[model samples]
Target: MNSFDSSIETYLSNLHFGHLATRSIASIADLYTFKGLVLIPVLWWMWFQHDERREWRREMVFATLFSGLAALVVGRLLTHWLPFRVRPVYNAELHLQFAGSDLNDALLSNWSSFPSDHAMLWMAVATGIFLVSRRIGVLAILYTALFICLPRAYLGFHYPTDLLVGAAVGIVIAYVMTRDAIRVRYATPALRWIERHPAPSGMLAFVLCLELVTQFDELRTLASSVVRNL
Candidate 1:
């Protein structure tokens, strides 16, 4: 077998065994689901419950949420168009073997496999949350890494490379957006627009634009090559 085929074989071996072990662990899915449900409310309590941060707390809260969503959507679409990859269950082609999951159904698989949305989204959220409060951010990332991302690989929803790349994308997006948010905090025009519009509008516009950019064949080929190298 060629190198690519060999890689797939390795993935399959790891995945089959991994799932058997994963079932034994207290479900990572449950941990992530609970975290997702409580993430926002908990963050709110952290920000406002502190009597000391009365003024700056609200601003920081808005920045973190707005920047996190923007990063997730932008990062997800940018990575999707690159090198269309077949997911695990659809391995009829025998091109690449992926981890198969018993927990999250293979039927939920979408196009492309190089970057995982869950990884990116959670990483982005954790990153933004971290920028606002070091204590909270550290906990969020720890929870995400332990529960959300590791389970994805254990269940075969994504490859190790996919998770790593998705995380890098998330971090970059979060850093960039957060930096911009900081600038906007000081800029009069930006502050005015942000106050006038809801938090979702900027993020929504970014997602639409990302969709358009990924449609071009020239850019798609460029992205495919980049991901292949990674």
Candidate 2:
């Protein structure tokens, strides 16, 4: 597995396009991967589709968000609980040729890379979409693999296996979570509130999506500060 990972990374490292162009593309991909603004609009498009099962659509959207959170929590727990594995870029053994010159080495120095949270979260959301609309779901999954996961591997942030595990786990969790019983239990009440109180629900939903786009960075930062103070 290590050999397979190394060979793939080695090949990817060698294909690091020219200087500025590669960096720019990677930067954009990185931004979209976490911000997920690109995918969110697509999800919203799915939400408002003129289908009879609008409630089911909304329920699946809620399941997407809820399952994404589940995937993230599981990813983080595994990241911390399992033995640490350094990112490919930091693994001197791989001799990875970084595609870009700029990286916040310090920020991720302590972070493990055995399982990618981005892959887990994004794939979970994509899986949820797929559950709702098979055609769109296929597109969503493909977009995630190409537009999101590929860049991370090319940039040396993750091994292919890391992404595979993360995505597999996310897909499974989302499939189960989006099951009729599970989604109904969690999303029905929220859907009812949205139906009854459109104004408040709109505002709250916007805030929630904003936070998801930003990966809840502000909230996590505040939590970290409180933890440090304690």
Best by lDDT: 2
lDDT of 1 at 188: 36
Q: TM-score per candidate, in order?
A: 0.63, 0.91
Predicted candidate 2 versus true structure: per-residue lDDT over 1-230, tens digit per residue: 37889789889888867877786667765684533786677677877787688888888998898888788789879999999998888777766677853664555667899798888988998898888889988988998898788888888888999999999999999999989888788799989888899999889878877776666767877987898899
- Candidate number with greatest TM-score: 2
The count of residue-pair clashes in candidate 2 stands at 0
For residue 130, model 1's alpha carbon misses the true position, in angstroms, by 1.8
lDDT of 1 at 125: 65
lDDT of candidate 1 over 1-230, digit per residue (tens): 24653474566535544555656442554443444544555545654565765445555555555555665566556656577665544545544444443454533454666677666766776787787778988988888787777766555555667777777777776677667456355433543565589577467545533432232324656886898899
Q: For model 2, what is the alpha-carbon lDDT of residue 89?
A: 80
Model 2: weakest 10-residue lDDT segment is 100-109
- lDDT, candidate 2, residue 82? 91
Q: List per-candidate RMSD values in Å.
A: 8.9, 2.0
